[model samples]
Each structure stands twice: as structure tokens, then as C-alpha cells.
Target: MFYFLPLLLLFMTASPNTAIIITPNEHTFRVHQRAQWKILLPRDYANPFDPDEIAVDARFVGPDGRELVVPAFWFIPGRIESEPTTRVATDEQLRQASFTVRFVPPVPGAWSMMVKVRDTERTQRSAPIFFEVKPAPPGSRGFVRRSPKTSHYFQFHSGEPFFMIGPNLCWANERGIAQYDEWFEKLTSNGGNFARIWMSRPNQLFETKKLGVNRYDQDGCAFYDALFETAERHGVHCMLTFNNYRDLVDRDMWGPAEWPNIPHNAINGGPCTRPTDFINSEIGQKLYRNRLRYIVARWSAYTSVACWEFWNEQTFTNVDIPPAWTRDMARYLKSIDPHQHLVSTSFGANSQHEVWAMPEIDLAQEHQYFGEGVRDASAPISAMARSLWEKFDKPSLIAEFGIAGEGSDIKFDPDGIGTNMHNGMWASMMSGSAGVGAMWWWDNYIDPKNLWYQFYGISQFAKQIDWINQRFEPVTLAPIMSDRSQPEIFADLIIRSAGGWGKSHGKPIAVLPNGQTSLGLPQYIYGTEQPRYRTQTILNVGIPQPTKMVVRVGKVSDAAVLRVVIDGEPTKDFAFSGLPGAPGQTKVERHPEGKWQAEFHQDCELEVPAGKHVIELRNEGNDWLAIEAVTFRSARSSQYADLETYAMKNEASGDVIAWLHDSESNWFNDRAKKMPRTISGARLNLSVQSGKTYRIDWWDTWKGRVIESREITATGGGELQLEIPPVHRDIALRATRIGS
Candidate 1:
């Protein structure tokens, strides 16, 4: 972290002379809120070669007497040296020379700060000014923070899960803000806490944003100030991208048509003759850095700003020296900004370029859009998100993903329920994304269509669990095939336990949020602190008849208590028990420290009757356990043995539940299969302990209400297999284990 705090340079460098005074946003602020002040330096105090001497400090002494000192960087006027045309001022006259000192007090207190500026002669410190910092209003979490305990998620300073659920409001200019406000209001009101805004539109929030370059757009700053204020009012977090790739181009990609308005074109007197050179050009970088400095100085202290995204799809515009440019700009932003917000850059849909892997970025993000022929189902999308998650191993998001836009062959859907918007959110979460995949075309499609409820559904389900504290890999079971005339209602079987082994490992997989499963040997898990954990999975399997059966539970390296049952009766009544593997068990030691090693094997089995049965595998000791494959058998049962359903587990409460849906049931795949929507009797086979009772509950997606509820006993068989009501869109059911 190469910093630019000038006062810290007392042991070093030479000098200059300056007189500076302070202007504060407030003589006070809320805790973790900005306590800002501007330092007006004499215009002649400019020194391009050594700008650090003019650094200003925003100091806050807390009630506990703990002091925090932050450095203020200049919000210099940018210079593109371009031809002055319609909207911008010429370069030479626009050399911005000003300073502002800002800092956030993380604690409530009576704090005093003095403005200080260094010069050739001496250090000038103003008389200390006092201010009071109250605590922020309820629900404000200061700023989004990376989870300290896990690598894949984010939590608020308030420690609540921050699951983002909204689309791109990139064109949110003040020109028609009522729409943007409505969008923001609807989004926040419907559980959306995120938005991706672009600051690139010409004269939107950045006048010389693309064309003239260096000149400061005071109007732009006011626009952004209002933007953040609006976000704060709606309780929404915004990810503002400084520049999007399309802005670099002077015309459309496939043709030679020129955009007369783009000022950065070589014809406009800028250095770059093509979009590629803009990133590599010294003049462009300088102007960009100036803009970055201004952005940080102004918006860095706002709680509503989630991150400072550098470029939107930097790789697409053929930008020269991408890695070097991304690296340099990321560093520059980090150096001048006192508040270290998250940073990221994106690429075209479904693509992960070299830049997405850059360590300078806090979040690895990409764009993905699926049209005709491209599979648009949540499972496939989950796989897409998972693939990135597996490779990046950092906080990740689908910054821009959708099936719209004029250039895209895919047409837009006003009703997003059966569209990507609905499935995409669920898929993003299953694939282990920090927030929902941002759908493109917010104002045009999402708002007017009343599709905000799509987000409400996703957020409601997401709020049920803590993604940051718990790591979950997708739990995949064999597809439970249904007769053509039957309702192919599969079960939702999410692992409701702590920690995980990545999803998918050849047979049945436990996929990591990144859409990947770990190989044998070196392994990484979210529940590293807990030495051991147990899982009592109540699987829903279909059994054609009340025939004899053999049940197999994959073995873990640790000790376990695996059992099988049939309709509340111990399988022993059916005369069945499981045995450990021949080798017993084996675990791969983690590299380096090698303190903890997770073990695995598929050597456990039992015998039970073939009916809708539940399998319960408890633990005798420490918590960690992995059952690679659970196979129920009989002679020729391999053809009959199957697992179908998706699970959602809530750890805050000891409930591990799952939903029932055909792997191919989503509308996207249905379009491909040309499958008709038909209703049928779906069977739910859950694994329960012998002698236990349960309240089997089923929710109907169409009616959005509980359609069925009944109590049934697990008469000691360790399995409760039963038939469910007619399956419409899908079945969301829960078998709350009552008593044993």
C-alpha cells in the first residue's frame, strides 16, 4: 500500500511555502460518517513535481482519546489537451489546482481537527476546530466489508449479510431522475441493496468524461453528490464505474461510422487516434488519474458507495497494455483515497480475461448474457458463476448479465419471472456469488414492467441464511426420473450444516459457490475453525415398490453414525445396517502448516425397504463429514436408485430443507426441450431417524401459499417416503422433525 500521506514524510523530502485555510462539511458528523473540510491553497501554490507538500490532514480525536489522522489529496483540474468543442473548456486554462481534506470518524466522540499545509519555510497548522460525531441511524452498516472469516462473501460493519439484488442503473443521469429514483425506491423496498452506476455518459456526471478530458465538470460533481444522497435515502449501495469501455470508441465496432460527439478522437486534438491507445497514453492516464483523485476525494466517504469500479469491460476496447493500466490506476486510487473501498473491472458476458485475475482488484467480476442456443437456466448459470468462483477464489459478481440490448439478438421480456432475471438471481446465489447478477437495461425493461418483485423473491429466500458466515457448495443428487404422465417434482436438499467440500466430484458432487469442487489432497473449507460437524440429511427419493433395498452412504475420514429407515421404522425391521470402508478412511493433509486434514471415502451401507424413505447420518464426535454418494440398492436397483432435488439449509435454526424441481423444469431448458407444463403427483422421500414424527409442509409456487401440511411418524425405519400434492412450477416443502 504505497500511500501519499504527506505529514508522514517529515523524515524525507524538500520543500515549498503555502498558506491554507479549512472549510468543513459539518462541525460534526455521525460515527463512521465523513467529517470533511476543504483547504483552499493559494492558486500559485501549485507544484506539479511535488504535490505532496500541500497535503491536508483531517484529524479526529475520539472520546477515548484515540486519534486518527487522514491525508487529503488534490482535486486537480484534468488536462486532455484536446480541441475545445461543444461542451468542454480548453486544457491549459482548466488546470485544476485545489485541495480538500476529508476523513470518517469510526467512533462517536467530540473530535477536534486542524488544517495543516507544508511549505518551504514551515508547517502551517490552523487552530483546532471541534465537532461532534453521533452514531449513525439504525440499519446503516458504515460500509461494505469483506468477510474476515470467509473469502467468498461480504458483511456489513453491522455484521448483517449484504446480499445485493438489483440491475444496472448505468444511465442514471439527472436528466430524468424520477425514473432512477423510482427504480432505486422500488429496488430498496423490494430487498435490493445494490446498483451498478456508470459515471461515463458525456455531461451526465462527467462533462469532459470522454471528449475534452482534463476540464472539471462542477455540474458532474453535483450530480454524483445527489446520486449518493439518493442512494442513502433509499438505503441502497451503488457500485460506480469510473469509465466504461464503450466510451473509448468513436464509433460502432462492426462499422466505420464515427460518433461526432466523442471528444477523445484524434480529430479532437487528443493523443489517442484509436480506443486502444487511450489507456497507454500518458496524457490520457494523467487526466484519468485526476478524475480518479476527484472521485475519491468527493465520494470516498459516502456509506452508500459500495465500490469504485475502474472500467467497465476494459478488455473489450482493445485497450493497450491492459494489465499495466489496470494495475497502475488501481494503485493510484488506493493511494489517494483515505477510505479503502472495494475495486473491480469487468469484461464481456460469460468471459474471464487475464485482467479479472489481477490481485489489485478486490472482487473478480465478469459479464454474461445468454441468447438463443445459449442455455439460460439457473443450473447452467449457476455453473457459469461456479466456474468463475472456482478459478478466482475471491469475492465475485456478474457485474453485467442479461439477455437484452439492441445489439443482442435476444429480445427483452417485460415479465421477468420466467426470464433470466428470476432464475439468474437464484443461480447467482447457488453458484456462490456475493450478490445477484446485475441485469442490464434497468430503466427500459425492469422498472416499467414491474419486474422488481423478481428481486423480492430472491432476496426473501436469501435473507433466510447467512452467506458470509457459512460456506455452501451446491448439493447435487442423481436425477429422479418421473413418468411422462407424472409430476416430476424433485426435492430441494441443501446441506444445512456448517462448512463444505466443493460441489461435484465425478459422481454426486458438493460444488463450491464458484461452481467447482476440490480434488483430493489439498482442500479448503469454510468451516475451518470447527474441528467436526454433523449433517442429518432428509433426502426425498422415489421408490416404485415396497421391495427390499440396500442404502449406501459415502464414508468420511472422521468417525460417523450412519443410519437408514423406512416409514418411521428402523431399517433393522427391514434387517439393514451399514459398514465402514475396507481401508477405513484416509484424509489429505493441507499444505504448509498441515494442521487440519479432511478425510473421505464411500464405504458405508445399510438396508431398508423401498418406499419414500428418509436417511439420517449423524456424527459421534467432531463435526466435519462428507458423504460422497448415497446409493439405495436391491438386485437391479442401480437402474432404480436415484437422487433428485435441491436443498436450502438455515443454520441460525437447525433446519436443513430442500425444494423439488426437475433439473430440466426451468423455462429456459423447457424452451429447448419444448416440454409442456403439466401437473402430476410428486413423491418426496426424506431420511429421518427411526421413531420420529414430522410436520411435512409443502408450498405451491403458483398460489404463493402453503397448499399442504400433515404429520407423519417415522415408525423406526429411518425413512419416511410419501407422495406430495400436484406440482405446478415446483414444490417448496419442509419436513420439520418434531419428536423422536
Candidate 2:
């Protein structure tokens, strides 16, 4: 009979007038649980999404006298298949349309709600409806936010830390919602708690509606309703990116030609005349603001919506997003979102530093893709994340990362080992990043290959660390081998230069018959590392072998000279020329002004002997040469052990976590090697409080469980030494102070 108590209360507070119908999902809601009121409006408007045409909102007054003005979103109810394997709603028929006001009750008490409806001319409000909220269930956490105690890490309203540990489930395939169901199940079951999703273009939300129209698609809205519901069920927090810059362009790495179909194109009646105008023009901003309103109204109530990202790789758009637009949108979003979720935007690797430094940007995100000549993924991943945090003084996230941008690692790794994917997750989390790096290629690689286990170990390790209150600082450790000799660390280093080739020389030397300016090549300038056409790459000698270096060159003027300097030695100009002088010159052509013949697409190689070296590449020619990439390959196997280690320690307490990786076990070398090079005897020295006894747990990364445990007390020098176990590829160690 206790079950009927809520139904009885629902009937008591609701008015006798049948014209205003209100149905609650529960008789009594719990704190942190969604309190939904499905109301059947007497009238229907043609465009419910546009608040200017018609608006519906609910005024909720909590027990603590806090008034929440929440907007009611339109909903077309439908039923999903019971226990279905896939999540497609294609066959289902829609029921009568209604408005839904969803809110998560913060405290346990009596709550009152009133629905207000407004049309073109008049406004009407329903009688106040009453309800009750109970205490939240055990272990239930509220919304996520950047911890006030620490700006770099996230915490729940319940004061529990939130460390994201999942990949990018950007969009669904033909199976629709069912695909997310399967993916989320596998991910969450393996300890994943976060996913990055895109709500742009043909695959997702906005494309289902007419381009440029203020109206939103009902079907798209339904998809998200199910998506959030599924995410909540699986305990996965979602980062929904509103725009994918590729949707605003005619072509991207994905491949394309049809600009007419692009929603942002002027031909589609969008406000922007070109892709670049989307971020700068006044009209574009108006439309974008409308879209933001609809987004907030529809999905802001969900506890699973962890972050609201404005764009995915906005730097890859036709023109980089200006700081003004970033500031305006972020401020606007903060104003509308009642929950005040975290906000951020992604950018191409090392691009758009000026915009990220703004105070409005909550998190600085970097997208990394390793192409040819880059074999080790962990070093660059750690370096880039650390660089963003250092430069911006905010939390950083590697939003999108993979071995290759053009394609998935499946082509190269048919066995589906996912070595880079594994290494990247460990590296980013230990690099003082907000959480694990969100990897790309989810559809073709992560899902199809069934690589969910890669997330397990890190999630297990994260469970033991309190990221918010601990204030962990990142540090590196060097291990000593049992043979009393330093271990060999190999790396296939990649050095990237600044700027592209064939840019205009600003002053045109001549005018063509078609009335176009004939611009000459820009003059080369080389002095220090900051000067144009000159860059430096620094690395310590890890292997006792000569490093193979390759330089990619494009379009060199006749006077263009390639110079290389090593370890303060005299500058040695490579044997290369533009006009029939370079040995590997494949093509030489005159510019539009016919100034001189210049070489195009040439490669220069050099071998630097083993030792500590500072290599610098400079162009001391009359005209510039577009140098794309410089690669240094160093790999050799010896009868010694090399472990790459990164750790984070809490200074107040002697609590710390460390990840150790095999030096030679990169994507390139691991595939070609026959047997696993196992290191058995090694010693690692870590910094801890003097004389503190700490319990150490050694974990098997693949299995995600502690294999062994021991306790050790630090010496007078504030150092604790651990005898390392056998490491096949990688391992993790968690040390906790016994008394602390």
C-alpha cells in the first residue's frame, strides 16, 4: 500500500480542471534524480523550437526558497523495443506531441512547479503543482564541475572527484541509437565513464532540419533524448560538441566536393557568405545564438552532459576562430545554462594560442595526429598536454588523438593490438592532464576492433587517487638497471617547422593578363630559433647509434640553401640546389613572374652520431623553402632494460602513482620484432616524505588488477626505492601512505 502513497499525492495537488493536464514520472522524486512533468498543452504551435514564436517554461521553487526558471522542451513520445540488441527507432510510431520540464532535484523537500506558456500575443500560467523529493540513493553523485579547490581537476557536487576515462563516440552509424547502446555498454563495463560526441552535420542533430532555418528537427531531438538516457543508464558522462568545423567546409581530411549540401553555405540560405564568415559575421552570430538556446533548453537538464564544447577543431575551419567569437559564445552559454557545466573548444595541434589564453575559455584542448616518421606516441602526447596546461594555466585535454589522421591504425595493425591507443591513455593521465586523452577513430578502429580493455587499467588506477584534494604534481623518474649501466631509450623523433610555402610576397612584381597580381616567393630569413625559416630540435642521447635524419622540402628558390648545425659545430650546408644543381631535384619551375627556377618536393638526409646533440635547421637563401617535417629515427635492441616513467605525487601526503613503459615498444618496432623484450631486474627511486611508510601495489595493465603488494619506508633523504618487477611492455604502480 506504500506504493500508492505517491499516486495519491499526485492527484491531491493537481487542479480539478482537466484542461491543464500534468503527469509526473514519479510520485516522489529523489535528490539528484530527474523530476519530469509531461504536460499536454491545449494548443500546438507550428514552430515550438523558436522561442520568439512560442515559448514554454516552468517556474520551479525548491524547498530552500531557490527559484529555478527552467525552459520546457518539446517531446514526441515513442516506445523503444524491450531488450533490443540495437537502438534504432525507425520502425516505431510517434505518439501525441507534448512539452516536458525536466529537472534534477538538489535537496530532499517539498517542491512547487508552475508551467507558463507564451504565444505571439498572450501569456498564461497553470496552477501551481506540488511534489516531494527524497534523499538521493547511496553512491549517487550530482553534476560535474571544475573543483573550486583546484581549477585543473573536476569534481561532483557531492564532492567526489571525476576523472574522465573514455574515447570519442563522436557519432553513430546506420544503426542509430542502437549503436550507442552497444558501444556504451562495452565502454562502461570496462570502466569508461566519459565520451566525446559531436552534434553536427549529416551524421548527427542539426542536419535533419532545413538548412539555416530557426526550427530544429524532431527526429534529431528524439535521438538525443535516447542518447542522454542511454548515457545516464551506463554511467557515462558526455561532452557534446555543437559544431564540427568540417561541416562548414567543402572539403576536409574525410574527402568531399559538394558545397551546396553544406548547411553553413550561403547557397543553403545560411547567414555566412563563406565558411570563414561563420565565426566573424554578425548574422551568423544571431543564428548561432538561436541554436544555442534550443540546445540548452533540450539537453541542459541531463546530469550526463558533462561539458558543452562550442567547436571541434575550430582551427581547422577555413579561418581560425577569432578570440571575440570565443568570448561572446562562452559568455552567452554560461548565461543560459542553469547547471553551469564546463565549457571548452578544440583546436588543431599547436594552433590558436592567442584564443585559448582568454579567461572565458574553461579548458584548453589539443588535437594530435601522428603521421609518417612518428613512431613513439606517448612522448608527444605527454609533451603536448603538458604544454597546453603550462601555457594557458588551465586544465587541458587531448580531445582527439590517434596514430594517423588520414586513417585508423587498423591498416597497419591488422592484429588490433592498439599499442598507441594504450600508451596515449596512460601518458595523458599521468602528464597532469585533466584525464585520459579522448582518442579518435571510434567507428572503424576502437569499436570494430573491440579494444575496450585498454581503458580498464587506467580507470582502476584512477580509482585510488583523489585528484581534487590531493593536488598531485607531475614528475619524471629515471630507473637504474641491475647491471649498473644506464638503459637505452630509443625514439623516432619528429620536428615540425613553421609556416607553409608559396605564400604571397605582399608586393606584386607584375600583373597578369587576367588582372591577377604576380607575386614572388618570400625572401628567406635565418638568425635565431625565433626567426623565420630557422628552427631547433633538442634531445638527449639515449642510444649509442647514429640517428637517421630526414628533411622534407617543398619549393626551394635557386638561392635557397639548406643548412644543418649539430652541437655548436660549424654550419654545414647540404649538397642541394634549386636549378639543376640538387641531386634529388625532381621538378624545377619558374614562378608566375619567371624570376628563377625553384625545386619542389625534395628530401634531404643526414646521419648524426650518438651523443647529446642540439640540431638546428635553417635556410640562408635569397628565397624561402617550405620545409614540412624533420624526422630522426633511433632504435636498437641491447641486453639491457629501458623504462620510460611518469609520476604524480601529493606533497602533503606521500601518495603517488607511476606508469612505466618499455622504451623500444613503439608502433613501428613492436610490429617488426619477434619476441617481447622483457626487463626483469630494475630499481626506481621516487620522491616521498622522509621516514613515511607507504603501501605499494604493482598492477598488471592488461588485466587491470594488483598482482603484488608490499610496504616500504622512505630514507632520510626523502627517497623511496622500489625493486621493479618483470615488465613485458608496460606496468603501473600506486603508492599510498599507510597512516595518511
**Cα-based TM-score, every candidate:** 0.65, 0.81
Winner by TM-score: 2
What would the per-residue lDDT of candidate 1 be over residues 1-740, giving only the tens digit for each residue?
Answer: 11122332212112234445567757558876666675665434433223333445566567898765566654433322112223343333233334666676667768787666666656767778787789876756788877786777887777777777788888753344555677788998778889998876532545442425443444455566667878888988989887766676544544433323445566766556766656677766776776676677668878889888877765555555557777888888877665678888775532344666777778887665543323333544455566567777678887776653344312334224445566566556656678878888666567656777777656665676567655554444333323335333322222211112332212223422211222211111112234332223343444444433332233233333444444555453111112233243343444233333334443444444544554433334332344433333322222211222555433332233455543345445544555535445444455556667777777653333567888887666655666666665455565666742
Those runs of model 1 whose alpha carbons end farther than 4 Å from true positions after fitting are: 1-19, 42-102, 110-112, 118-130, 202-211, 253-266, 271-274, 281-283, 349-359, 404-418, 481-679, 684-725, 731-740
Candidate 2 global CA lDDT score: 0.70
The models' CA-based lDDT, in order, is 0.55, 0.70
Candidate 2 structure quality by residue, lDDT tens digits, 1-740: 01112221211122345465778877879988887788766655655666777777888888999987778776654333211121222312223456777888778899899888888978888999988889999988988888888878888888999999999998887787899999999999899999998887545554421423565555566678788989999999999998877766787656773344645567776656787676777767877887887788778888889999988877667675777888899999888776777888886633567667877777788777765335656766776666566677677788888876778877756677878788888888987889899888888988888889889878888887888888887765544444446554554554433221212122212211111111211222233332433433322333256877777775565656677776667456754456655566767776644545555556677778875555555566655555555556753333234676767778788788888887566676656754558888777778889999999999888788998899999999978898888888888999889985
List the pairs of residues colliding in candidate 2. 87-178
By summed lDDT, the worst window of 10 consecutive residues in model 2 runs over: 511-520
Worst 10 residues of 1 by lDDT: 517-526
Query: What lDDT is reached at residue 458 by model 1?
Result: 62
